[model samples]
Target chain A: MPTFNKYVQIEDKPSMVPAGLEKAITAAAAKDTRIIAVLEDMGFPGMLWFKKNCPERMIECGIAEQNAAVMAAGLAAEGFIPIINSFLFADVGRAYNQIRQSILVDRFNVKFIGREGAWGEPGISHNTIEGIGSTRPLPNLVILNPADAVEAEKAAEAMLQYVGPVLLRQESSPPPIKIFSDDLPFDIGKAFSLKEGRDATIIATGYMLTEAVRALDILEKDGLNVGLLDMCTIKPLDDKAIIKAAEKTGAIVTAENGTVIGGLGDGVAAVLAENLPTPIVKIGIEDEFSQSGKMSPKDELKEHFGLRPEDIAVSVKECISKKEKLRKKRK
Target chain B: MAHHEKLVKDLEKKANQIRRDCFEIFGSTQMGHAGGTMSIIELITALYFHHMKFDPKNVDWPERDRLVLSKAHCCEAIYAALVELGVYPRKTLGTYYCFGSPFQGHADRWCTPGIDYSGGSLGQGLSFAIGMALAEKMKSVVKDVNIGQGGFLQRYVVRFDPLYRSYCILGDGECHEGMIWEAAMFAAKYKLDNLIAIIDYNKFSLDGPTNEIMNVEPLVEKWKSFGWWVTEVDGHDIRQILDALELASKLYGDYRPKCIIAHTIKGHGIPAWEREHIHLGRGAVIMKGIEEGRKKYADV
Candidate 1:
């Protein structure tokens, strides 16, 4: 019903604390002594803010991600909350068994923060253009793929209060803010409606959430209302919202910076296929390792992965047109 | 003191009986790790029935001390000790590897009730012990447990809510896992002198001798390099295992963990099981003819 009109230059780049991740961490740390952080030693001066602010709470376990995961498991088992931070690929590949046996098997309430999911050519090393599929089978894990810094911060804060294991994937670079603060805290297991429409529901996570929101604008201009939901919590999903959207909308497009098979798209499909079958299109990195790109290739890579807002806009328009034809045939 | 000596002597007799019991159990199973079980009997007996502070009546008492059999194939010895110590019923020893038995070949933490951790995987027990020890310190309840009834709602809170010291029986072969080295480094870093890791250095491994398979020779020097107060002893010698453990407890300095390399023969009791190359995937290596290997020597 209402839109924030602080509209500025509207550029693509965003600030590091775009959504309030820093603020949330600061506030959360002040209240809980169990919060300890193992920062990656990749020389990101950005975390110098956290380390300097909470010297007693922050412990860097050197470059050993495997050891860090076990250390976190040990701390969690002993009633301390530890966040082992690294990129998604390294954390998953290096410490799969540790997470499987020590963390998941014990059901220890530890937190894993994978800072970047699929950032194309931040260096191919940083790109997990195909990441999320590998994570779906880990039992009892709650997966959160936040769209922007604000959502990331809120999710991070909400998770510490939870009594089970949680993982939050963060974007190395911030994206456009699609959902402004309701001035109220967001709870886990609920999806936020970025835009309300009836044409088709587009589900997205990671950097693609903002793109989905922008694509909905293009649909709205064409007099076709589109539904947009930021599916932040992928596991123990907001099934009610997804099923309701599918029942009303009849078509969907899911996008993520992860693999197409098991990211946000598959999660939505599993729910819809069981409840209300619908035509769905998915966009993400295919099964291929990312190649080297320009030093500043964010824009180019975003387009390459069909993650640009304009690409989403086109997909949305084509789906609506196809649906209109099919409806006519039904008539 | 004479009475204590008599109890120790009685315990030795019980150990010999347990050796026989283990043989029967292994024989019935038609397949079991006999050599290891026979080797660690006295060590298990001394720790469970005599030294370690535990409550058989209240097994999960938070304050009670913990003993992890890292060399868990010798679980027959642990099970035998637990049965004698009254944690498990004596009848269960007969069902060692029997169908639907709570006991299995190697101790499974999920399956075995009294064992703190299931450690057949090797090298993992040290890490688990480190966590337990750290938790005990953090809880700040520094006392061992005493035997008691489930009554008395306002008991002494057991003087301790977790163990002040933790004992682990590690297999010399389990030292092959690199994770052990990492755990050692961690122990050193945290000044975990309260955590005593004892290597069940029986000279034999499954295939043959550990030294020939992969030398753990100069084991003390290896531990010393990892910043531990290393002690070597005859594993089968109750006095030596006890003295080395006591000496290790007293050697206090920051960043020096304790590692006791207790050496013992693989099959110290049964002659055939001692150094014989029993073929792989075959049963009853120590045949009926050579029960002389079953002779008990006054090695102590």
Candidate 2:
């Protein structure tokens, strides 16, 4: 079972976001004619489908990402919702200033579907973990990183429906098992609580949620009650849910597939430090570039980076111990 | 005088007025990009007064032609145009570069009225113009196709005939950025005939001469190789600038974008301002140049 929660019906099959984005965008395009696809040679699953369906709506911008970014801003200014898809490094990293000055300055309604993760053959050049950190500081830009196929689809739909600039980080990683049920209630900037816990809460995003769910089972078998909070929307972060989690669990362990420096870990830590102070352990790529990792039989990068379910369980215990030590010191 | 002669005379007078307005703006702020701003005055004046289809009464007109001032540091010229066109009061010129003012240091579409694209970064405006051109082409294309009884389909049949043209003004020194060529190739590939670009070949950047700083030499050939219809015009001459822009606007169905290399002095008017390599000036120095420019315009 992928998820031990009663509300979530885990599908037996594994899936990725490129497929989910394809389904979500194509469906969204059918209804809204304003949607346009601006690609940077990295055709992510939906390019061919979009070309076949709406030929004129899909633009092939070639390998020029900077031009593509400003072009999307122009299209957005004209009231057409332009979606630029590429690796996060090329889409955000290469065109950082273009996206900042041209798009985010006036807050254009541009959707960027950036793909990147640690577990891939593309190596460090393509898989940049700094995207979440770099983009989080930009004003008027919303960031979303979905955990499962269902959430990806739902997030894409929500992203399209919303106005202004948004970046949906589609992870290029091993397929995640379906976690959310069909009738999952998804909202922008809101966190979904799978289960409540008394010992510690696991706050995860993107591909790390699958490992988090598995960690929940491991902790349960060891006679521990751990909660899981799916923080899909990284920007405009769900603060109430985080405070509630910290209040209930008194300890938090953050997990993500990207670097923890400016990613979800730091975001959660900032929130907890300000609102409700809680002992926390961050589980992610610790201040390093991602290299080539095997993905077939075993995700070697996950093991190498200490992001496995067992690693998360250990971090949870460490966080709980920190909380206990703090209580003892207060006495 | 002939009708074209009268039109030329009117544009020349408008250009002179805009030059004075630029001086007024510089005098108020005591800081401005004087050299490049003076060089592009005739081009801006002609576009606002004669060429572009903009309504000063309604700045946000849907079908109005767009202008992407890519060399946006010299937005003082555009601000002068807005003042002359009655979009803003003359008092607003005093607020230029202030803490809270619509007339910002650079072209900002949100802050300033009649500005199409927010720009300060060079080599970015051409791509934005292409986008606006593409959008205009899309809108002028097949809105809906009807095939006999009860057969209505929405097809994006990209018709090249766009109702409104999109123009971008670039600086010669700004061509050093590689993204300019990237946008140029994309425009040629897509055959955006509705787009027109003008390069203010003023030869000087902030540091020194453009060729000495980093040459964008053989500039016309570079654009031509990127598949653009290149034209050369004496940028200071109002008649020649209008003629080039007119030819570019009328060259429809050519399946190529147009570029006009406007060779101009760094500061076109006022011999004192033209003599100095003053890309930007502040306080007493800029105030001195504006005074000299006012004296020269009055004498003319």
Worst 10 residues of 1 chain A by lDDT: A1-10
Give candidate 2 regions above 4 Å deviation: A1-7, A44-46, B1-3, B143-161
TM-score of chain B of 2: 0.92
Model 1 global lDDT (CA atoms, 0 to 1): 0.66
TM-scores, all models, native as reference: 0.80, 0.95
**lDDT score, candidate 2, position B242:** 87
After the best TM-score superposition of candidate 2, give how far the Cα of residue B201 lies from its true spot, in angstroms.
Answer: 0.6
Q: Which ten residues in a row have the lowest lDDT in candidate 1 chain B?
A: B147-156
Prediction-by-prediction clash tally? 8, 0
| Local accuracy of candidate 1 as per-residue lDDT tens digits, B91-191 | 78778777677677777655677776555655666766765554444444333322123111111122212245767788877888776776776666555
Cα deviation in Å at residue A317, candidate 2? 0.5
Off by over 4 Å in 1: A1-22, A38-60, A120-122, A129-131, A173-178, A182-185, A294-298, A317-331, B1-40, B68-83, B88-113, B118-122, B136-163, B203-218, B252-255, B265-300
